[model samples]
Target: MSQIRLYDTTLRDGTQAEDISFLVADKVRIAEMLDDLGIHYIEGGWPGSNPKDIAFFKEIRNISLKQAKIAAFGSTRRARVKPEDDDNIRTLIQAEPDTITIFGKSWDFHVREALRISLEQNLELINDSLVYLKQHVGEVIYDAEHFFDGYKANPAYALQTLKAAADADVDCIVLCDTNGGSLPFEIADIIDDVRKHISTPLGIHAHNDSECAVANSLTAVEHGAVHVQGTINGFGERCGNANLCSIAPALTLKMNRPCMTEDQLRQLRIASRTVYELANLVPNKHQPYVGNSAFAHKGGVHVSAIQRHPETYEHIRPEKVGNLTRVLVSDLSGRSNILAKAEQFNIDLDSKDPVTQEILETIKNLENQGFQFEGAEASFELMMRRALGTLRHFFSVLGFRVIDTKRHGDDNPLSEATIQVKVGGKIEHTAAEGRGPVNALDHALRKALEKFYPQLKQMKLLDYKVRVLPAGRGTASITRVLIESGDKNSRWGTVGVSDNIIDASYQALIDAIQYKLVQDYAADKKE
Candidate 1:
């Protein structure tokens, strides 16, 4: 089988995305993660661009990488400057990376319009920079920026650019769709034409402007390119770059090419989520392979089909990408869907059981009332337990009160909450203050429950989300709150809905605490 190299530019190109910035530590962490994923090249950053990147290079030198070669990214020498005299080239050498990737203008339009340099000078810069880097670096990869658009406009000049890099003995010539506007057919044809002119190993770096970055990269590989350049989760400037998370599996499982080992491929989901976590961005749950909803089935027909033969609905096993198949319960679900869900929960429920039909009706009714259980599996499970007459009593809420007061000249209002709860036949009353009414209520409730169940300290609210359901009554619309709660070992989401926001938040919070106690109760029974 042919081997295609996975080159990750998350630390460099991926960070160019708006609202996506990483600290020096985050950069090093992601680099190590990429190496563990068995990537061929990990572009650390553009060392000469900023102090943060330079610090990254300095810091990364101390850590040892196993599989990937650390690369420093830069541009060709400036107009009319010798390669040896350019500060950018000199700084790249100082970084002392295993590979040096320098991008040179491949389009005649960019040479004249962007760089304001004659075509001949641009070619000399490309040749001189690659040759100079090759002398100091173990391997040098030349990035032909905007090569596809350039070729479409002036084929001769584009070919001339690749020829210059090939003559310089660069290890590989990477064709870049910088604008990301090229179609898959154009990429395939252009790569074929470039191969006819030069014998150099070819690579692809595509953007997602036209939403074809992954398609373009695959097309290039199908044609002749052996190296794929992309970012995790497709993050980059504008629309983003080609997503290696998508590209890796396609090359390995579908195309019969080896990009990473099976073991490394299994780590793709964790690595993808880690990058999004470090960037403080929400993971895209609907992403191609590794997303939470990737192999999830909601419709009755799809669920029944998948239960019989997963291949009927899924292209690949979810476990292959570190994700698992999910059978979501909704109004559209059928008896088969209920049975499948029951099987996942280890509950014994037959398809013909009256409770199964009752649960289905309940789900449809609750959904009509603005209660979505799709993302709140804990609440759904709790409902099942109650319907099955297996729910254990943890605590019972007696009453609760919240007060918000604003003093003269104080812009912020002080929120205070008092709660009374009965835990194991004893009533506990507690009060607390917080920045907001919801926080105050949470503090007060947890305070009342802590003395009875000390394990409450181990659990805390991770996230709280609120949504207003559409209603003709406008401001009187019902509100729904989803609370994400976590203990040290795991996290679960619970939801509640009410006309009052505070009431909705309180309901969700109660569910969260009850869920934790139920887990403790189960653990105790197991012991």
Candidate 2:
């Protein structure tokens, strides 16, 4: 197999996903990241569509990309308009990209119903647009929109469309599964047949409506397609486009087709996460290859086997894609799970020790009470350290009180919190006001502790989530709270459970503070 070209459409088709939008600066940063990852082509947005896209094209030109060729996307000329006269075609040249990619109607149904043009007129549109772009741009790619459906509807006309692009001397012709409804067998069969007629290099662009975008792209490659187009994290309209995160690895590791260097492949998770962060969206932890849970082992049997040999459970090494294997502790965990987690935290433990068994039983009981430790490893670590008599007592909470008052004509209630804590026999009491009860409590706690531990001032509560366990009981349900806290250096998660929401929040907040202090104490001891 030849080296497959990796083309990224995250900036163009990815933005079509619902609730996904990026600033111009975000696009530039993503482009630079993609280039660093060894992408062959980076498709910027259609310059004629929106001002933001136009600005992205303008901003990206100033940045020096390492390896990728920037391509501007647009549609072919309208039904009878000359290619030079069409605004969309003109904007592609104005964007000043190294390459131009234009999509033309390939399905007879789309040409007749969508474009409302005759069959011969559509052919003329494809030929005229590509021929004109080839004259101005150094490279031009032709995307056959709905190519699979078009081939199924009228194979002769689909071949004719490719013939038009081929005669224009385009760089590569990409077949798009625009509706994302085709299966792998159909994709393989169609590409097999298309290869017999078109001499130009072929590419595959798939969408995930039927949840086969990744499979379809792989199938096409197996059948001799050279170029693969997809978005990072599979961001696109409706079901999303093919995920390059999965495709890139499958090609390099499984198919024996080298699309990127091993080092560049290691940055896969970082690139996937960076795009999600810029989009302001929570990442799908279940996503393949780059997700947090991708290599995590939960069952005791699986954990034991993986500890002996990672290949027993993992398809490939997690570090190959910048991910790590994690052992989660819960009611289902056994001695092996405890040992593995101890190894991860760099805490020495013997599996035969009775304390290990005791800790395991405590975790099972806690999980039975709805205290989950999968996402709150910090809390679990502190518990283990306390059981082992290795944890330090930074401070003890004496008590805390929060009050909310509402009066007539007041749109919002006033919240205040009073906190008392004892640090090494010194009592500190403080009061603070905030927008809400939780915020007030946080402020009061910090104020009381900052005098002794000034480092606490650098910590911020990044996220807080509450889940009511065994729902339908309404106010009587047990509430589980998870708090994410971060300083300038790192972040950690702590969890708490209680019937009272305030008490649950307080428990989680206490764990967060204690974990930070413990980390600082350990660093000081090492020094």
Candidate 3:
């Protein structure tokens, strides 16, 4: 089997995305993560462009990487300047990365319009830049910027650019679909033609403008390209770059190309999520291979089929990518969905038990009344435990009141919540102020219960979302509240529904607290 080199450009090209900007420390952490994922090259940002990237290259030298070589990215030397005289080239060498990757104009139009340089001048820039960098850096890579579009417009000139890099004896020549508009067939044909003129090893850098980045990348590998460049989760400028999260698994499991070991492949999901979390961005649940819903089954028929054979609906096992098959419960759920979920929760539930039917009926009815359990599995689990008569009451809510007052001159409203709760034989009343009614209620509830169960202090409400159901019009519509809560160990979701938004929020809040107490109680018993 042929080995494919995986080059990750998340620190450099990925930050060009509008939604992504990493601190110097964030870049180092992600580079370490990429090294752990068995990537061959990690492209640190351009040292000449930003101070943050320069700091990153300096800080990263302190940490020991296992196998991945850090590559610094920049453009070729300026048109009229010598390679040794260019500030960009000087800074790249000072960064002291193991490898240096510099891009030059491949398209004749860009040569004339973008760079305002003669065609031959651009060739000299590419050749001289690599020759100079090769003396300072251990290895050098040449990125043929806009190579696909350049090849399509002027194939002769595009091949000449690769020839210049080859003449410099650069380590590799990467053809870039910079505009990201090239099709897979076009990439295959262009690469096939380029191989006739250039004997250098080839790599691919693709963007997702036309949604063909992943397909084009794989097609390049199929056509004999040995190196692949992409960002995690396809994050980049405009439409983004090819997603290594999807590409790595495809190369390993589907194409018989081994870019990483099986154990490293299992960290694909973790790597994808870690980048998203560090960037303070939400993970795309529908993203391929590493997404939350990649192997999720919701329909009754699909769940039933997957229960017998998962391959019926799934292309590959989720565990291969560090993700697991998830059975979501909803109005469309069948006995198989319930049984699958019961097994997931480690609940001993019999398929034929009357309680099973009762839980199924309750789910369907509640869903009809503006409740969604797919995002609130903690609430679903609590409901199941209640039906089995195994759930312990942590605390009971006696009453709660929220007051929102807006002064005539003040723009901000003052919200206060007073709540009373009884824990066994003791009753506690508390009042708290917050930015909103829900916040005040949450504070008051915690104040009332933290004395009884101090472990509740560790739990935090992470996210809160409210959706208005179509059951009624405008202000009369029913609302559903989904609350995401987490401690240091794990996170879970709970939901509630009611006509009044505050009442619905209260229901979800109560479930969130009860779920945490139950988890603590179970942990204590196990200990």
Please give the CA lDDT of all the candidate structures: 0.92, 0.94, 0.94
* Candidate 2 per-residue C-alpha lDDT over 1-527 given as tens digits, one digit per residue, 9 for 90 to 100: 56899999999999999999999999999999999999999998999999999999889888999889999999999887898899999999999999899999889999999999899999998998999999999999999999999999999999999999999999899999999999999999999999999989999999999999999999999999999999999999999999999999999999999899999999999999999999999889989999999999889999999999999999999999999999999998989999999998888999999989999999999998889998899999999998999889999999999999987675799999999999998999899998889899999999999999999999999999999999678899999999999999988999999998889899999999999999998889899
The residue-by-residue lDDT of candidate 3 on 1-527, one tens digit each, is 45899999999999999978999889989999999999999999899998999999999999999999999999999988898899999999999999999999999999999999899988998999999999998999999999999988998898898999999999999999999999999999999988888888999999999999999999999999999999999999999999999999999999999899999999999999999999999899999999999999999899999989999999999999999999999999999899999999889999999999999999999998988998999999999999999999888999999999998775899999999999999999999999899999999999999999899999999999999988648898999999999999889999989989999999999999999988888888999
C-alpha lDDT (0 to 100) for residue 392 of candidate 3: 97
User: Per-residue lDDT for 161-257 in model 1, tens only?
Assistant: 9999999999989999999999999998888888899999999999999999999999999999999999999999999999999999999899989
Clashes of each: 0, 0, 0
- Collision pairs in model 2: none
The lowest-lDDT stretch of 10 consecutive residues in candidate 2 is: 404-413
Candidate 3: which pairs clash?
A: none
Per-residue error (Å), model 1, residue 485: 1.3
Stretches of candidate 2 off by over 4 Å are none
The segments of candidate 3 whose C-alpha lies over 4 angstroms from its true place after superposition are: none
| Deviating ranges (above 4 Å) for candidate 1 | none
Q: When superposed on Cα atoms, how far off is each prediction in RMSD?
A: 1.1, 1.0, 1.0
Model 1 pairs in collision: none
Which of the two, 1 or 2, has more lDDT?
Answer: 2
TM-score of each: 0.98, 0.99, 0.99
